[model samples]
Target: MALSVLAEENILLNQQLATKEEAIRLAGQILVDNRYVEADYIEKMLEREAMTSTFMGNLVAIPHGTDDAKKDVKESGISIIQVPDGVDFGDGNIVKLIIGIAGKGGGHLDILSNIAITVSDIENVENIVAATSAKSILSFFERVN
Candidate 1:
């Protein structure tokens, strides 16, 4: 069962987003457009944001649907969008990478672990942020896999 997290199809490189909400919305759309989640999952993600900040540090933000959105996930999927200038996620946190996540069953845990391991190293996150093309970013996951 492929979790399909962070694939080339779900990546948007060098994106310029004006606001955190827009960034979150665009990231959720990537998953929806790819059929990884239901259309309403975007709203769920926004709802989750209201509860707590998904800021995981290392210039990264892992935004996922709220508990209510669990039923909205059609398949497990993730989308990684890079903001070159970064987006302020409030409290002075600028997120260079916004990772939108959706999961079916418990598969999302695998995605979380993979992302945690990949970005645990600051330099690895930097490399991902510096990737010029989506292919390169996909390769980064391959190398990790």
Candidate 2:
């Protein structure tokens, strides 16, 4: 399966955000504006983030949610955003890469795991962060697969 089924290359972009809140807001807005999810969905994800930091370290934040708003997706989707200045994810470290995942009805674990593996690779992660366009990031998946 292609990640493109869930994420659109056009939706991914480089962000110049100054704070963690702004990064999350921008990511959430991307989903809403593209009809990938409802507006409240972002808030709920942020609430989840408050309960526990989603910062997995190495300047990465994976914010995810399993809700009714995402039940119709058919497959999970991931949107990648690069914040140039980095944002504070309440983890004492700045976050430069934001990965947002929204599952379908259920059974999105596989997709999530795959993404985790991909990003966990130092080389792969570096390539993605250094990518100049969404096309470059999308191509990384091809090599991984």
Candidate 3:
């Protein structure tokens, strides 16, 4: 059976992150804690940010490791963080929702694409950002895609 990508324990709601790096670490740490990725994958996630911003607009940021860091993945999983106040992702981008991804092999594309499609709608993005329960967010994603 395929493992669930977004576990309830991996979702953090109503958080206030001071920096983008802290937000990234918080997101990536969930993956590490859940055994979805090696601890070192968090550092690689930072390196990915240096390469390019993961900001997807509508106050969302998807942080993932670089292509070379795929080896650090143990399984396909995602960590979600809801920052109601929003964290600055630089260049005036304030991200209220953060999705950290650890995909084995080329699975990141599928995860990214699904999220992209779901968040493309402003209503969906708003709903996700305002979600107070992990199950609500998870069910929203499942319903959308």
Could you give the C-alpha RMSD of every candidate to the true structure, in order shown? 1.6, 2.5, 1.8
Alpha carbon lDDT of each predicted model: 0.88, 0.69, 0.91
What does candidate 3 score on TM? 0.95
- lDDT value for model 3: 0.91
Better of 2 and 3 by TM-score: 3
Output the better candidate (1/3) by TM-score. 3
Task: Estimate, for each residue in 30-130, the C-alpha lDDT of model 3 and write its tens digit.
Answer: 99999999999999999999999999898999999988888899999999999999999999999999999999877777888898898888789889998
Indicate the worst ten consecutive residues by lDDT in candidate 1: 1-10
Best by lDDT: 3
Task: List, residue by residue over 1-145, the lDDT tens digit for candidate 1.
Answer: 2335667889999999988899999999999999988899999899988889988999999999998798999989999999989999989999999989998898888899888888778788889899999988888877875
TM-score of each: 0.95, 0.84, 0.95
Candidates in descending lDDT order: 3, 1, 2
Model 2 stretches astray by more than 4 angstroms: 6-11, 66-75
Off by over 4 Å in 3: 1-3
Candidate with best TM-score:
3
For model 2, residues 40-144, the per-residue Cα lDDT tens digits are 877867776767777887778887653544653434566679775678887477887888777665545766776778878767767777888777777777668
